[model samples]
Target: MTDHALVLFSGGQDSATCLAWALDRFPHVETLGFDYGQRHRVELEVRAAFRERLARENPAWAARLGPDHLLTLDALREVSDTALTRETEITMQANGLPSTFVPGRNLLFVTFAAALAYRRGLRHLVAGMCETDYSGYPDCRDDTLKALQVAINLGMDRRFVLHTPLMWRDKKATWALAARLGGAALVEAIRVETHSCYLGDRTTLHAWGFGCGTCPACELRQRGWEAWAADPGKDETHD
Candidate 1:
């Protein structure tokens, strides 16, 4: 597409992958990150480092992706009760909303991103919210996304397309797609650089991108990695 794309980047695995995917698809890409006053402050640092590294490693990519592309909104820092933002203990619930589910998080993020897009004259916005691996978050559901898309357009008086590349894809499928779009090295870079840990622990290896591996996010990530490792042939290498 010739239009620019804005991504809701969390400096995490899925979002990182989504960022790369957006880069390949859109002529211009910008990222919007939230400093929602989560329990993990290290994630913000990690995100900053990621942007810097991406700029240094690939100058062309960096030039295409400007430093001004990174936008940090601090709306959630005030409300600190949810697991994703400020809870100390993480519960692994089989069903229902997890402690990490922040109320109106995606809504706020998407709203801000949409506003940014509208200002930049960009109609496309991409996010990495997957219902399959999500921790029972209502915002990650397909219906919510569709409704939000409509709401954003109606509210902003502009037509905007919300691109959920990993909406239906499971964790395994996510890994496969990452490999396909950005290759093994890029995927590996995402795994290491991206912060998926809710607790902000950077030590040890988990099934997920990087965390205790017991958390819902980590579990899904690990399972996806295992699936990819088991069947490397299924991994796509082309766009």
Candidate 2:
């Protein structure tokens, strides 16, 4: 039997790319999105629309990649102290965690994904968290994910794999990966359809993903895209 992989998708560039990657690798892939009261409800809406589009375009792909897929909106809404999920205005710091960082977010999200995977007899849980463009979020680091993996296993009395396909890769490499798996069309679709701006502004494009082009997330995304566009050869993965 082909092993099933559960993806923690956020309907953003990285997560959407990771979802595509999972689709290419695993015969059985399901996506789980969190609607954590994010300031950008647009992201959740896009996620639902993407899911629907997939179902309409390729029902088999949707069936294999959608049946266990879910959106946990209420769970995130209940915890609204973070700016990303609440009304608080985001504050960007030079070298510290941004106000956009949601406390215990990935922990809670992955825990839930793991629980769902365990119940379904799936051993793999995939997430798209990159340390390179993460902007000081402690939870986005490799160490945090490794530690969480161990904790999840101990807590659930079962072994589970948390796969971060984008952990070591930068945005340029990520864009290349998307192209490799599904060509430029997929990459373009991701940029156009996904939501990355913490503030929900979608008027312009930032290098890493689409956003306000001013927030730290937008800055990192913009820089990455500029870097890649300047030198496509920089990404060895590019064909």
Candidate 3:
């Protein structure tokens, strides 16, 4: 695989950390995001603002980071009935995986990203998918991602490395990683700028990010921060 990589940026804490990971490793890096009829579309706005900030404040890194590309999957609107896209009050848990779990969302995202990577001659596709301290989403598992990597490569007839920097790291470790990657400023920005709230509520800011503070994602992040603030000695194993 070549050195250039494309990151699946969602402007969330994990993806932002993974972007920094790509910046630290590969010489050439870019970002790709999707608009798949998600109610949390505000993250896209944050994504654009993040790229703009990187270009303005950190020009040296931003130059190699390249442009942030956004694509739309309008079909998702018709098929998905999840709270993330539907006009229903978001539900934390249900009979099975939470109502937020859009079926095959990650699968579709990575496949499309792989195609884009092949077309652009990029060899690596980085994403921020975590199993620990994450919502019960099967697609976020490592095995699922690994299988998809092989399938995508064979389907595209190209060798594309899929990098998931946040697969094992919990939310606390993710914050520490952000501190290591972009230092204090980036950490602070991630806390305030990124929106991980399932309800898309930024009115009540939490220690980690803006959220409704009651949703599963927000609860997980808050717990991680509690642990992080206790003994956050720059430890990668903050969890």
The 10-residue segment of model 3 with minimum total lDDT is 230-239
- Name the best candidate (by lDDT): 3
| lDDT of residue 98 for candidate 3 | 83
lDDT of 3: 0.82
Model 3 lDDT, residue 85, Cα: 86
RMSD of each: 2.8, 3.1, 2.1
TM-score of each: 0.88, 0.86, 0.93
Q: For each of the candidates, give the backbone clash count.
A: 4, 4, 1
Native-referenced Cα lDDT, model 1: 0.76
Q: Residue by residue across 1-239, what tens digits does model 3's lDDT show? A: 39999999987777887887888888889899999878878888898777666556566677788767888998877788888888786665646788888888999999989888888889999999988778879999999999999998888888888888888888888887877877787777778877787777878776777898887778887887777778676845522
In model 1, where is the ten-residue run with the lowest total lDDT? 66-75
lDDT, candidate 2, 26-99, per-residue tens: 78888887766678777767886665655555555666775646655576667656678678777865557677
Q: On a 0 to 100 scale, what is the lDDT of residue 12 in model 3?
A: 78
Against the true structure, candidate 2 has what lDDT? 0.76
Tens-digit per-residue lDDT, 86-131, candidate 1: 6567865565667788778888888888988888888888999888
Best model number under TM-score: 3
Clashes of 1: 4
